[model samples]
Target: MKTYHIRFYENRWIYYCISLAVVLVGLICNVIFGTRLDIQFTGGAVLSYSYSGEIETQKVERAVESSLGRDASVSVNKNVRSAESGQVSNNVTISLAGTNSITPADQTAVLKALNKAYPNEKFESLKMDSVNPSMGQSFFLKCIVAVLIAFLLLNLYIAARFRKIGGMAAGFFAIFALLHDVAMVYFTFIIFRMPLDDNFIAVVLTILGYSLNDTIVIYDRIRENRRLMGPKTPYRVLVNTSINQTFTRSINTAICTFLAIATVFVVGSVYQLNSVV
Candidate 1:
């Protein structure tokens, strides 16, 4: 295998500049396009309607907006359920995520608009759900607390495991790496206009574990190298050598994870599972 030596420490400032650029761009995009919180985080109304025939999603969106005078999302799932009598049906979920509940009059008007738009679709209202904004805010706070607690627990564990050579410092850096990973994910949702939902939480938790594992592996290698290289070794040399030794493993791990996530995303797209995508 061909190996190329790279001086990461010497170019650390470049990496910092790149990270700062990304953060600034993300913040710019966030300001241009505000954060979209899902019903779980923002109080909203969800109206699910079963349709007998083909209904274009764009038409549904237009109908809702025209009737309600507000923005809404329309997700259409195909062949979602099958009746025992061999009739197949599709579902259209209309979501109005805002601070207030959708009024009955507004819902009726929305239904009328939908019916007027697609008279042959036979849209039947399945269910209407309203989420309380205060409750959603509370739930969102709880999720944040849960993530923070997880980070704290993981830091404690790392500190305990690596107590011999400045365990707290190691743990702090590991948490810093985790924070970077999380910030990327957060900025991605903002940039792409994806709603912060359960999927966001799931992705964050998954990333925490994934990143922590990689951090631990590198830290373990560093610990081993420290013992092998003697106490008199320069700190820069120790860190550089340890990182170089584990670079291949880190690359392979990242590639494998990317491929796995790509596969799942493709599958979700095929199934029209927008949330999963």
Candidate 2:
């Protein structure tokens, strides 16, 4: 069998340089655009309404801002209806993000303001959802705690299960790789000016598991190779050999994952949130 042999450690600096460039660019974007926390994390209200005909989102934003005396984001979409139904409705979703909740009086005022601005549009409230500031803070902290617990538990497991083949070192590098994945995800969100919300927490935790699973597969291969090649083998050679053995499997796994993600993105784009009401 023709086996591949590549010295990953020898080219470590190239990877390090690439990672540093990513961080530098993220920092520059942060200075220019800044980061935003979603209402799910920051605490506030999301008031979604169905409006008649065409109306500018900017008008809705201005009306809400005037009513509440705080900045609000308004998203307007037309032709939103379920795939099963022929009926469609134009909607305006207003997001009030802050450390304070929107009060009932304020909600009433915003509705009045919108109706007054566009009497022809006939605005009607579909739903109102609010998150307490303290509750949001608590939830955010819980997500952090969950991630920390996952890391700690995974490390202990790896160290116990792979002790014959530098388990502690394997676990450390695995965690380090997971952190790199997390940082990249965070920076991607910040650079795109996306809100760090529940979706952010969900994605991070999901990536943690996925990345750890991939790491464990290579570590398993390494443990098997170490036993076959005997303990006297050089560590670099052992790792490179095991990695070469697992390279094809890893590439296949990544390709499948990418295709799954692409499928979801394409479906979402095609539907244009018609199911969202």
Which prediction has the highest TM-score against the true structure?
A: 1
Model 2 residue 252 distance off true place after TM-score fit, in angstroms: 2.0
Clashes of 2: 0
**Candidate 1 local lDDT, 97-143, one digit each (tens):** 88766778987898899899999988888789987778767866887
**For model 2, how does the per-residue alpha-carbon lDDT over 231-268 read when each residue is reduced to its tens digit?**
99998888788888877776787899889877887786
Off by over 4 Å in 2: 1-6, 31-33, 53-70, 76-87, 100-127, 274-277
lDDT of 1 at 197: 81
Q: Judge candidate 1 against the unseen true structure and give its global Cα lDDT, from 0 to 1.
A: 0.83
Q: Which stretches of candidate 1 lie over 4 Å from their true place?
A: 1-4, 52-56, 82-86, 119-122, 132-139, 266-277
TM of each candidate vs. truth? 0.84, 0.78
Worst 10 residues of 1 by lDDT: 1-10
- Whole-model lDDT values for every prediction: 0.83, 0.83
